[model samples]
Target chain A: MTVILNQSFTGVSIGAVLLLIALGLTLTFGQMGVINMAHGEFIMAGAYTTYVLQKPIGDAGVSLLLALPVAFLVAGSMGALLEWLLIRRLYTRPLDTLLVTWGVSLMLQQLARDIFGAPNVQTTAPGLLTGSVSVAGVNLATSRLFILGFALLCVAGLAAILRTTPLGRRIRAVVQNRDLAEVSGIATGRVDRTTFFIGSGLAGMAGVALTLIGPIGPTTGTNYIVDAFLVVVVGGIGRLRGAVITAFVLGLLQSVLEYSTTVSVAKVVVLVGIVAFLQWRPQGLYTVRTRSLV
Target chain B: MTTTSTPPTAAPATEPPAGPPETPFLGRFLGRFRTPAAFLLGAVLLVGVAPLVLSDFRLGLLAKYLCYGIVAVGVSLAWGRGGLLVLGQGVFFGLGGYAMAMHLKLADAAATGETLPDFMLLYGTEGGLPWWWQPFANPAFALAMTVVLPMAVAALLGALVFRRRVKGAYFAILSQALAAALAIWLVGQQATTGGTNGLTGFQGFFGYDLNDPINQRMVYVVIAVALLLLMAAARQLFVSRYGELLIAVRDSEERVRFLGYNPANVKLVAYVVAAGMAGLAGALFVPAVGIISPALIGIVPSIGFVIGAAVGGRASLVGAVLGAIAVAWAQSTLSDAWPAGWTYLQGLLFVVAVGFLPGGLASLRTVLRRRRTSSDRVGATKGVTT
Candidate 1:
């Protein structure tokens, strides 16, 4: 029973990480229909930001906390730059955008390798995160609990921004109908850059959380990119509620399967499951009804 | 059929399927002489000139390039003309490669009077040859399995994906996921699949000694011939009526559906054929390179395949084939000089090709021609078009 409870908690924690990683992708891919393969690199950038900041700052927890917003700005600016430079030119061609972004991803990975060297880097978390706090006889690691709480906080913050703010309203307007939004005097281009920024910033934040758990390297982002994309895909294009639900479901499914099977087998099964599931619900968990035809 | 045999290279390698619905003036002017001319050029370069000019080691390298070129031919058909960005070709290549490697390993073990391959012994021959590896012992069965397995997987996957009308970027992501999954699974199966190092170290291919220069040359010739045959087949597909239907589907699927045709089936054929080609390449790659590892059949390698096709012009048969060879050749040479440089260069090439030169090197002529003809409009189209 303890094992089951622990495993379930593990599943939820995994879901939170997955959600954190995928939130940016969901926003960018959903809003612009641009597949930013470099989003993973943004996560890597966030992680590296954490690592870099730990050098000068004596307080591990202070640097870690400070790293979140700093990582966001760094990754967001990079994303905005990408949107302005390359992605904006290929807006009419989504397939081209994918390839170009993949190219960008490769360069960014190389850049990271050159800067950080090929070896994996890790940052020290404050004692607050590193230590475990027992609850309900589960004895959960505080790092994981921190990650889960942070993920929820980010999601809540995103929801508030999207639902309440004028920029959020503008983003939603552009997402629904770009031409209409443009005619209504909304600067779709600026919105796209902002959306990319926030989305990529979230990925960076996810990266910082990742440093608490494990070592990170140039290729770290590549490892999670596909999984994040899968989460976004299953969550259905741009719907946050759907992304939230799908992340947990996928996380739980992967966790339960991993308990019984090997990690590789678990992954393969999950992939096959996603493929099969997509066949049934090609649009994913949720989709906005529209009369618009491509 | 004869009409379809017109030199596709002369025609810019796009549109009209079997025969141009309206033969562009360039194709018409080049029509009669160009087909035979192109065929003669291929024959002379590959069969006559290459063998005489290049040494055995260089020839072997060229053979490896040709193997990649074979995969690129299929990528062109599916991605270029059909507009199906197939990003996960590595899965099929891996499938074919492992199939061949299994047979080679088994053959080596049998020759040495061992019950299992060396890796099996190292990892654990405990369960005796897993039931799956048992059949690959037969040479013919292994060869057939190489092409068949990848094609079968592609057919299944393509059917599922295309039928539901899931395409564009979504399809690319799903395909990439398959490559990642397969790589992870292979890595985990340390005992059965040879794990990370993958299946390597072959003494012989069929009965020929791998170390013998003569036999090595034979392998190169086989790869070259195989690539040519496949390129011809792809060209045939491009000119066939079905090719036109594929382009139609790509350009406007709804219209194709309205015309009482299943867009899924058209896509399935190209995808399956492309998989078969990659599988063959993987099989041949085992003999030429003496290795088939997860590293070579992962997301990066899959992207490498598409990058080659993109560089050459996915829509052009000849261009894709040449592009794959050029990219492979560049990797072998450039990486040796500067290990880190190749990755950046490759990315740069991919971005430039996809963003600026979507039609690839094959379309350069068209772009230049258009620029000259419309000279009055200065700097128009920035000297290119999608």
Candidate 2:
């Protein structure tokens, strides 16, 4: 019973990290209809931001706190720039977006390698977050608990903003119908840029959280990319609530499966499961009814 | 059947599947001649002229490139003509390659009178050859399996995917995931598949010495001939009514469905054909390149196949072949010069191609011609007015 509880905790923590990453992916894909393959790089940028700040600040906790916002700003600006330069022209061509963004992804990965060096960089966990808490024979690490909280906080904040803000309203309007939104006096382009910024910023925040779990590297983003994409896809395109639910389900499932089989086999099983799931629910967990929208 | 055998000057008996009806008999004749003429010329250069000019070593490199060209041609058909954007040719390529490689290993074992291949002895729990590797002992069976395996896999996969009406990004992601899954699976099964440092140490291919210079040259000749033959087959598909149907499916699948034609079947045929070609390419690649591994059959390499066709212009057969060879040649040359820089260049080229040069190198001529014609018109008008 303790082992199962511990496993479930582990699953929840893993699910938190996936939720953070998939949130950004869900927003970008849902709103813009653009598959940004460079998204993983944005996450990498955030993690690297944390790495860079750790040295100068000389306090792990303080640096981590500073790194989150800095990472968001840096990744967000880069996302907006890419959106303005390359993505704007390819809105009608989703497949072309895949190819172009893939190119962008490769370039960004090389850039990371050049800047950070090829070797993985380790970041120390904050002093307060290093220890574990035991309850009923289950030892839970503080860092995992913090990550789980952080993920919830971010999701809540995003939900609140979307629910209450005029910007969120504009974003929703544009997403529903760009032409209609334009006629109603909203600048769809600004909304697109803003959404991309927020989405990439969230990816950056996920990166900072990622460092709490493991070492940071140029290829770190790639490690989570396929899983994150699957999360967004399975959750349903353009549905934040669905993204949250799917992420936890996938993450927990993988965590449990890893205990029984080799990691590679577990991954294969998960992938096959997802493929089967897709066969059953092609539109995913949530589908928006639209007229003649292919 | 005789129509296909007729002289280049002969008017085609079969009506061209596409193009305007006003296209004259002479235009149709030229259209028919164009592909075969190009094929003959390319065949002559590859089979006849190349051996004379290139050294044995260079010819060997060209043979490896021709294998890439073979895959690229299929990519062009599936992506360019069919608009399927298949990002997992590596799955089929690996299928073909492993089939041939297993056969070679089995045949080597039989000749030596050994119970199992060397890898099995080195890595397996039991010393005997696995049951799956048993049929590959026959050279004929191995060859057939190379072609049949990919086709069957593609047919099954295509039926599932297309029947579900899963197109666009979902299809691309699923296909890429398959490549990734296959690679991981292959890497995990070291005992059976020779994981990581994949299947090598072959002495001969059907009694031809791999190390002998003459036999190496013969291998190149065979591949060059195969390339020409495959291109001919692709060209036949391109001009056929089926090709028109594929284009229709690409443009608007729903409209095709409404017209009472099954878009899924059309897509399935192109997908299967592409997979078969990729498989054959892999079979040839194993002998020429002397190795096959998970690294060659992963998501990255699958994308690599599409990149070659994209660079050459996916719609043009010659372009696909040329693009594949050019990209392969460029990678070798660039890597020799700067080991770490080629990927950056490749990425940049991919971005530029997708963004600005959507039609690839094949479209450059038309762009230039349009500019020249406009300039000439301006010149002629200025002179008349003056």
Give Cα-based local distance difference scores for all models. 0.87, 0.83
For candidate 2, state the interface root-mean-square deviation in angstroms to 1 decimal.
Answer: 12.2
Look at candidate 2 and tell me the lDDT of residue B335.
78
B-chain TM-score for every candidate: 0.91, 0.88
Residue B280 miss distance in model 1 (angstroms): 0.7
Model 1 alpha-carbon drift over 4 Å, by segment: B1-31, B372-375, B378-385
Candidate 2 local Cα displacement, residue B270, angstroms: 1.3
lDDT tens digits by residue: candidate 2, B1-386: 11101111211112213666899999989987886687788889999999999998899899999999999889888888888879889999999999999988887777798878888888754846678888898899999989999999889878887887767777777788778878888898888899887898876899987889888888899899998998988888988999889877776777889999998899999999999999999999988888999999998888888888878777778887899899988888897998559879888877887766666787676546545766777453431100
Q: Who wins the lDDT comparison? A: 1
Error (Å) of candidate 2 at residue B170 is 0.7
The weakest ten consecutive residues by lDDT in model 2 chain B span: B1-10
TM-score, per-candidate, Cα-based: 0.95, 0.92
